[model samples]
Target: MRVTPPFAPVTDHDLAVLAEQLGRPARGVIGIAARCVCGNPTVVATAPRLADGSPFPTFYYLTHPAATAAMSRLEATHVMAELADELAADPELQAGHLRAHHAYLADRARYGDVPEIAGISAGGMPTRVKCLHALAGHALAGGPGVNPIGDAALARGDWSPQRCACARPGPMLDAAGVAE
Candidate 1:
């Protein structure tokens, strides 16, 4: 099932929130692909070609700090090799991954086609599980079942979309007993 929703235009407030989360200005952000439970952006959909005219295959970029940390931890364990082994052994998984590759391409095409990366998808998809971060980002943006490898990585990881792990304060209390 292709779970990637249509892109929603980025707003200035969304960019501000992203900048705060990333500790740098957000660039080439076309839309917010996924949001935290507290409504902050968790995944951003970026243009295939950056402003400087470089080909960036990572269309669904994970931005939530907690989620990124979780993916990084998984990567540190060298889980990609294990997952790559599984991918090689499972025919169903290989088919699902190919579908995900096509889905990723379709998603990137919406932003504008960049011929340099026409057949390429992020995270070494369809043939290898190279980057947990990119796969996890795709899972977050496309939701549960779209990318099998991505979904598996998310399931194996510690972070979840169901809960809010945002560093920002929630409903701050003011002296007047009103939320700030």
Candidate 2:
């Protein structure tokens, strides 16, 4: 989609400040660069150069023009969507991230206080609100997802023991105490 910079008027004071920051001669070049960054044709498009006819050391602050522009609600939403798309595309990375998230959440569920409304089905508002309330117990407790075990670890220096999968206490017991 063809995106435009968010519309905002710049004053002479703003231009002066930008030029001072750019450290170039006061020829409005920095203003043009800002415009270019803001996705505007206002920039005079000759390659940036030093006063002595040498190339500028770096194309300082190279960024998507739209992003550099004055942010608007629509532009911000579009940028957020772009970032989300970038995050979602790589399956391996996404899976790894989700695995970490699942581990974190599962750990929280195990050792943390269960939310009062944990069992609401995912559907409409009542369900959603209830599910949200279920998660909100952490915040109500303090911050989000403060697990008792993790808290205990910090407070009492009680680290969880590592269990080797190959080693069992005995034959795996049933849900009850019956041997399985």
lDDT of each: 0.84, 0.27
Off by over 4 Å in 1: 1-5, 169-180
Candidate 2 regions exceeding 4 Å error are 1-77, 113-180
Q: How does candidate 2 score on lDDT?
A: 0.27
TM-score of each: 0.90, 0.21
Candidate 2 on 56-138: residue-level lDDT in tens? 31211312222223223323345334423434665543443333233333322332233442331111112111121112211
Q: Best-fitting candidate, measured by TM-score?
A: 1
Error of 2 at 131 (Å): 17
- RMSD to the hidden true structure, all candidates: 5.0, 27.1
Expressed as tens digits, the lDDT of each residue in 1-180 for candidate 1 is: 464747767767678889998999998998888877666788999889999999989999999999999989888887777889999999999998888888888888877889999899999987888888888888888877788898988888899988888888234324332335
C-alpha lDDT (0 to 100) for residue 28 of candidate 1: 92
In model 1, residue pairs whose N, Cα or C atoms come closer than 3 Å (at least 3 residues apart or on different chains), thus clashing, are: none
Clashes of each: 0, 0
